[model samples]
Target: MVSKAVVSTISLILVVGVALAVVAFVHHKNGTKSAGENLSPSMKAMIDICGMTDHQEICQKSLSPVAEKGSMDPKEFIKAAIQSTINELSKSMNFTDNLVKNVSSSARLIKMGLDDCKELLQFAVEDLQSSFSMVDDNDLRNMNDTEKDADLKNWLSAVISFQENCRDEFQDAPEYQSLMTKNLQDASLHTDNALAIVCNLGDILKYFGLEFNIKPSGGRRLLSEDGYPSWLSASDIKVLALQDNGRIRPNVVVAKDGSGQFKSIAAALATYPKNHRGRYVIYVKAGIYDEYIIVQRDQKHVFIYGDGARKTIVTGNKNYRNHKTQESASFSVLGNRFMAKSMGFRNTAGPEGHQAVALRVQSDRAIFYNCRMDGYQDTLYVQAYRQFFRNCVISGTVDFIFGDSATVIQNSLIIVRKPMDGQFNTVTAQGRARKNETRGLVIHNCRIVPEQELSPLRFKIQTYLGRPWKEYARTVIMETTLGDFINPAGYHVWNETSFALETCSYLEYANRGPGANTNRRVRWKGVRVINRREALKYTANYFIHAYYWLKGTGVPYLPTFR
Candidate 1:
């Protein structure tokens, strides 16, 4: 017979094992409950805000510290997004700098590409900081303030563009390109998340059950009853009222002959006043200036005009064969609030000399009135920021009018020149890489026609309105007259592999001409034929928020569709 001691021992062991199992189960259940309960209000708010973005995990992780500090304001979240982008970009820039240091001197292109990346990263950081400042300064709770919102979006979009441009510099170096892609991925993602939050800010606010006031559209006016911008100062009105250049007193004068104070435009630019409050005018006499002119970044509120577009010219021939596209421009404007009138900028690098830029504008709130940009390829590079071209003429062959700026060419003429044999023509190649970017090319009430040389060969040499230079390229040809030379397909794909047909935005509204028929246009998913209501969104008043700054420039602009 079994002993009673053995039976008692076995029973005790079974009881102990069951008791331990029960305790472990209770602990796990309580731990899960504790985790749920421990989620702070700030953490929950961060989750809610980040959930609206495409990259939720990245967004949440990047913004965790910001959330932990505990204010649930949507603006704070937006600020955190921008801050995160800035931080990542700084790190990426350092990484690029290290790569530059390690690169072999024999690899010139690679070194140049990395150097360009470093510069671009710096620009991206500046742009993100600008966005951050805007968010921090303004009470974005009033979602109806379109001007502030547009400016914020523009800066963030430019950050993305700068990052993409950095990567694009390494197109020929796949290995380097891959390295850049990996290095910039986090920075790009953070910028994208920031832009997404800004784009869907209204929805995010609504999600928070926050109440805000909307500004009435009817209260805003583009111009006063007396036919002038209501916001123009007395001094500005006086300057605009002067019809004759001789009568208007200029701060400086430039002349090829020794009659003026400065013999060259560059000399006149050197006289820019330090922190002057008002417009500083520079007038140039009728002469051809064979110089590469750059209005430096610090030169703001500069009003430079010439005798006439045909008489006074700034010409150069720096093509891609010798210099970088950014450095090949005959004229580059980097200042804000810059205005150029009755001037001509041309790149004499003929069609054979590819990727030559005539006028590269990186200025914000810039105006070009009655000016001309003449080149063969990559003519007018609207590099960044907001630009307005009124009553101007732009002539080129390939991707002539291109860049990542919020630009409007109104009452201007687009001349399409014949390209080399086997080469085609594309008027615009807008470099908007992200959908949330507010940058685009808007051709309003302009004329697009072929030059006399290209007229006969129009049928043989195909021409497209635009091509997707970047993935989210956007161009709107509305209220413009298209010449017969424009291809029936309307637009062209960048290449076989770069067919951004689904992501790019190409729109034509109320366009009239033989080439304006949408019936035969390419059936791209992103091409659209919209009504007036939709077209209004692309107007000067809405697209670039022109009314806010254009009023000061005194350039006549159609705020809305006629």
Candidate 2:
């Protein structure tokens, strides 16, 4: 009864409905895309940005909502990456906090570890905020700065270190360790992704039509002919001049004999000026003061000196027997731009008191010139930031000179002390945990010798240049003299697993000594005998970007190899 046109229309409608149903079935079957379907522009862009990271899936997932906004700005991508890290870190911190709250007081070690994890997570958040601030403040679309890039990477690297250190506190609690690891996995992955993006920031900027200028090693010198950093302030120059002429005036003095304004170093530090500018000088007279000293975080631009390294001593005996390693420091400096000269920091806990720290330096751009750090184990904790040790003496037995800071020890003496019997010695344990971290120990033009007690026992007790302390541990020994006491193998593995051997970076360049021979060195993938060009990369100028801050301290350093 119906017309032919009506019948044709029904047929067309049915065919169209079938095609739509098939497309819907295919889309549901393949979560990403249907067969022969092209990806959305924003999704493609997200893949491209996250392709540089180790965790592409996490990166893409974290950035999916941001990508939906359809903005391709690299800065936006970086900001999102940092935000994702902050989110994950916050979650982990909450998880740790709950664990700490629920932990029983009877489980002292576990409780202590949880408390440490909570504190470390707080630090991680602070570091992430710092990184985010840098990205948020700068308009990367038009800026061609490298220092900012380096600073961002450094902060992110510290975040990773803090997370790892939190996990390390649980070495005695395996169940807690596994739980913490699971909790921190996403945070760690997010951090790694953020760091990778920062490491490749220049390339990313270039892709977005901006050139990130990374100055070459051969660029203009940072120092002027007057042997000062070009960026040194006029007031800093006057202070250094006065120091050189032996007419320097100190803001405060500490004398054990009650001759100065303060009788003790701790008392002197208590009077630090709030929101002060320029250098706050403290002179400690020649005497031994048995007290723990901490230069608190707000005390900036502090310069403390003593009569001489041997004459003035700050001594303590706290060790692993009773206190946490972090709390066992004779002197801990948390202030930025701190400088110490001609002073000795000691932990007289003896070898029996393992993991006693002589000096713990967390100050940024800190300088130790002609100072001595003495202890049996874990002597100098170069905990963080850029530190310079020039003409200094550091003595220890096991993992003595260990930390995660970007450190350079030039024209110094590294003494290997006799350890407790059945225990060997390791001079340095650079704790660089991630590949993108700008942290390492660069021993340049130094002498590594055995202490008076260890000299004879050197034959029986083995000593190594260093060992891999973390997955990406990095240490460079260049133009240094190593004693015959050092093991010919040059380095040691962290464990039988040797997991770090394939990831760490150990380089020896132009080192001359009986133990410096690379012929008998461990055949690790990361160990290398570098050439001159490679050696230049580890020098003061390039390694820590010392030009920006070192010269300002008035500490004599080799900007390049002599």
Give all candidates' CA lDDT scores. 0.85, 0.85
lDDT of 2 by residue, 37-109 (tens): 4545555566667878888767776777777898777778888999999999999999998998899999877
Query: Estimated TM-score per prediction?
Result: 0.89, 0.89
List the pairs of residues colliding in candidate 2: none
lDDT of 2 at 345: 98
Q: Clashing pairs in model 1?
A: none
Candidate 2, after superposition: displacement of residue 136 in Å?
1.8
Task: Count residue pairs with overlapping backbones in model 2.
Answer: 0
Show model 1 residue runs off by greater than 4 Å.
1-38, 104-112, 216-238, 241-246
Candidate 1 has an lDDT of 0.85
For model 2, give the 10-residue run with minimal summed lDDT.
17-26
